[model samples]
Target: MDDLDRKLNDAFPGYVVRKDLVKQVRGNAAVPSYVLEFLLGQNCATDDEEQIKLGIERVKDILAKHYVQRAEAGAIRSDIKQTGFQRVIDKVSVVLNEKRDAYEATFENLGISRVLVDSDTVKNNRRLLVSGVWCIADLSYSANEAKDESPYLLQKLKPIQMSRFDFEGYAEKRGNFTMDEWIDVLIRSIGLDPSQMGKRAKLFQLTRLVTYCERNYNLIELGPKGTGKSHVYSEFSPHGILISGGEVTPAKLFVNNSTGRIGLVGYWDCVAFDEFAGKNKRPKADIVDIMKNYMANKSFSRGIEQVTAEASMVFVGNTSHDIAYMINFSDLFEDLPTVYHDPAFIDRLHAYIPGWEMDIIRGDMFSSDFGFIVDYLAEALRHTRALDYSELYRDHFELSDTLSTRDKDGIQKTFSGLMKIIFPNKEVTTEEIAEILEFCLEMRKRVKDSLYRIDETFSRVQFAYRPVDGGSWVNVETLEEIDFPGTYHARDLVPLEGESVDEAVIEVAEDHSGTTVQEVSAERVSVPAIEEKTLFEGHKAYRENQRGVSFDGLFGDYLKGARRIEIIDPYIRSFHQCRNLMELLEVALRYFDYKAPSLEVHLVTGPDDYDVAKQRDYLDQIANAMAPLGLDFTYEIDMSGIIHARHLKIDDSWDILLDRGLDIFQKFDSGNAFAIENRMPEMRRVRQFEVTYLKKD
Candidate 1:
């Protein structure tokens, strides 16, 4: 085991399992992750190789013997008839037979129905009434004389869930890991690799967990498909139910007036609508109205009574167009159905996760590392719902005055939810508080900003915040706003400090904003204006997975007239790093005078420790490639290993500090020549980076 794996195993014994084991044991079982992990947690939650191997064998034996497969249902039923009783693991859902006055159970994969269930079992596992719960059940077939009683009997049943959770104990153990480590632990628990993500990206992933832990929280994520938007609600927890967007009805989600019975919202902690963005989808109008009231008030009218439920709501679906197209031609909510397109419904969303900012699901992104058993995590989250950290930030920061009560509430709920997930012990720093508050504020701001584009009647609340101790009001803008500032803010945007709102910005915005960003009902704000991209002499931060950033845009204005450039990046040995160096040269070539004698670009970098020869070869190739374009590229291997600082010095006048050197962009489809990001650097989502331009003495 690696150090982190060892640490996790030592700290959280019997609560975590090697995550990759799920795929190994799950050979087409068609079960949720929590179900599979439940079994694994009982058997393989250990670091010992011998015990894990034996556990895997035992679990495999159990599944082979007891796991019900629909295709083999007849064989299993025949076996039950012969043996008089059979133990099977299957999805069990229950319904009340009004005339018979008895609860009937259906084993989904076992292909058995009309099984008689006792009132005690039905009352104990009420979730079975709302959604199919994966459970181990003892079934016995019976040949009865009564036609209505030709039946199977349910002897016993156990739902696949963590029966007990200690929130205090879990919160206490959290201190063993740092904030970053804890975040990684949670990310791994969700089966994603934290090494491949940045702070912002990690936060985006954690926002998915907020819906589970925070009661009545509303979140929507609309982006391109295959980003795993529905994965969390579907597989991460047993307490959450993922339903098709079109399948929603007032009776299914809220309450049935006919029977006076509660629905999914009353039973499940989280109810998610998958594939929710198709404009053609005709969900019941009543569903939209019900959702509007429930999302806002956390209560819905049932006959003559008010029914309250704490179920969080999530809407996730494929966005038809890219962000640019949606921003220019329509708004981000373009794919939402006409019925749900109301401002009242949209306003209830506490946070709109920019799913486009999420990296697509890749096999490599799944971790083989240790993570908590999902059931444990789910139970912990379920227990944490009772705790409210919404006001935790009041001591550190305050919201903008322009924000409405709804906007502030959204921010508070989102912030509180994140705190519950990340800092369950309620231990946090002022900077950390500011960081999360800003993130949550921007989330709500994204919803608000898109609302403005759809309907200008929505007030332009400055989505900014200030530190309670004293600080300038820090403005929060969605990443889309940063990329497409002009149209993203459709109306005339307040200019940056000292810069006049000029016709030039408007012209640029109009020219660039034509072909991009979503939807249906509101009159879209079509005034496309660009915020000036003028460079400054201070630090500039760029988010990971955020597009519309390029080396040319960043360095063009600064590197325009330089004759000589000195790049000291110690870690330029890898192929991507070499590509970055090459791209920087191209940026310089785009603006520099190629007709000059030669633009000298020299680099001082360390040799690749693993493959020094390949490093030399790459550098030599870069030099050879640049020499022909009247750009003399040279390099020196700083064997002393002291050259760790990365900065660009041009013409001995400007020194630009690069936190990540020229390797700003994340790994992408460079192999696919057709990839637009390969041809246009601005189209690429960058790795989180910061640059500071300073005047050298």
Candidate 2:
């Protein structure tokens, strides 16, 4: 077992099983992940593989004989009738029957409705009725005449996850376990193995845990699709409901004014809208307005009375365009329905998860070591809602005065959510607090920047906070500067002229390739034919936001006798990655006019991991396509380990050191290929790449 698996085993003792065994015992049973993990937790939450295998076999046998699916519902009913009592696994949802003076059970898969449930079962399992509680139900049919049906069955239900948690007792016993062990217990409780997750990924998982702890926190995620945004909301919790965007109705979401029936908000702990983005898809204005109000105040108006609910709201959507396009042309929230794009509605959101940063969902991302049952974790979160963790950060630092009330709220909510998820026990350091604070600020800034793009009237505020210890204030925007140089404008590069603050405004440029940058000595240098080469004088055009500028226009007019051009980049494999190389060739092709001058383009790149056969196939196709256009492409993998500089040297002179190299375009979209910019090469979308030219030594 891995350290994480061992830790879970040590933490939960015999109650936490490896995540992989849940699937094994599931066999053909169509159940949620939490249900499978619950069973695994009961019988096989152990490190002993032989015992687990045997336990899994037994569990499978029990499920196969008991679980009710659509095809076997009739058989189950027949078995219950003949045997007078039979155990069956099914999703049980309970509703109050006023006339009968008892709660009735609704079996989703069995197609059974209004089955009379025992009073003890109803009263003892009030929480089970709210969300789908997977249970082993004993059905006994009686030949009694009722208004709705001639025969009725008594459902003696047993929930898989009973309310057995002793929160106070657990709090008392929590001191026995070390901090790392407690973290493992939390991980095991959520049915996940910590070993499989990286530090950043663990933080993300913790962020999702806020839904369990906080009440009515509004979270929105917008990015490219298939990032598993809806997975946790749909599959992790019985207390959470995932509704399709089209299926959500005012009657279903809020209280129904007609019959005075409370909706999902009254019952579910979290309500998530799947596929929530699409500009053309029109939504009800009333829905948006009511949601805005509810998200802000945790209450909605139904007739004259205000009905309050604790259900957190989640919005998951896909963006048709890349981030750069959205940043340059429109706001990030532009993909949202026009009705939801209102500033009031946007302001209510606590955090905006940049779904693009989340890696695409793959098989390996799932944990197999151990995690708590998601339902159990969800219930724990629901209980934690009463606790306020937001104030923990105030003692250490102060928020910037420039930030608005909404901005401050966003930051605090995010900080609280993250704290509740990660540092629930309040065992953390100043460094850890700073890390999470930075993340919270970034999430809030995503919302702020996108909103700024939509409405320029909003003033730019400093997303920084000062520590109380008289040290420097932490700035989130400065972190962006560390991550990307293009994040800062050219005018921001003015060198400071003071000896006192020399180190404070120092410029640190790291060139690991051993190429030293000498200050320009233009006064001593004599130019030969440099004045005659005015090719780039008028054609040179550079944009502030452009990732990489094509040098084709700059040196094309002066490339009459150019021969060999060498380009280097460490990473160049994907189609987009290769397009960076192709762009370089596009620049090189400009130098040749008469018979293309037999121009040779040599590319030194790392070895491709995406199938050699496919690479050859793609290159062959490209060669065939570009052969008629007088462009020759040749590439070699670097095995010598000699070259590390990312520069393009033309004929041993006129070198260009590329900061971001040539992979300048933002993520591509196949759906928007018909757009004019996509069709037009020059007008094609490109990201930031810096190029500085110098004469070769």
Per-model tally of clashing residue pairs: 13, 16
For candidate 1, write residues 1-697 as lDDT tens digits.
6788888998889999999999989987888889889999999999999999999988888889999988998999999998899999999999889889988888898887878889998888899997789999988877778877646888899988977788888998887888899999999999988988888888988999998889999999999989999999999999899997546678888999998989899999999999988889887878888889999899999998999999999999899898878876678888998888878889899999888888889888999999999999999888888889988999888888879998999999899999999999999998889889999999998888777666657756778889888889888877777776546665433344666544213212121224432321123334446886555888889877788788888888888878999999999989989988888998898887866888999999998989999999998998888887889999999899898789999997889999988888877878899999899988888888899999877
State the lDDT at 188 in candidate 2.
49
TM-score of 1: 0.91
Model 2 bad stretches (over 4 Å): 98-102, 123-131, 147-150, 166-198, 478-697
True-vs-predicted CA distance for residue 22, candidate 1, Å: 1.5
What is every candidate's alpha-carbon RMSD to the true fold? Answer: 5.5, 11.5
What is the per-residue lDDT of model 2 for residues 1-697, given as tens digits with 9 covering 90 to 100? 7665565556556556676776677777888877777777677767787888887887888888888978988887787778787777888888877777767778888878888777788677665566557888877777765576525475467887635765554344455555555655565455555544434445555666677578888888887877777878877776777887734778878977887878888877788899999889888888888888999899999899998999888888999987545543355687888888877788788788766555566565556666655655566666677788777777787877878888888888778877766565666677767777877887787777555545545545678877867677676752223323332211112334663322323222222233532331212122355455443321122322233234454345434566777778766666666655665566566556646437766677665665656655555665565556666667777756566677666777567676656655444343486865444444443443455667656
> What's the C-alpha lDDT at position 136 in model 2?
82
How many pairs of residues collide in model 1? Answer: 13
TM-scores of all predicted structures: 0.91, 0.69
The runs of at least 3 residues in candidate 1 whose Cα sits more than 4 Å from the true structure, single-residue gaps closed, are 98-100, 491-536, 590-597, 628-630
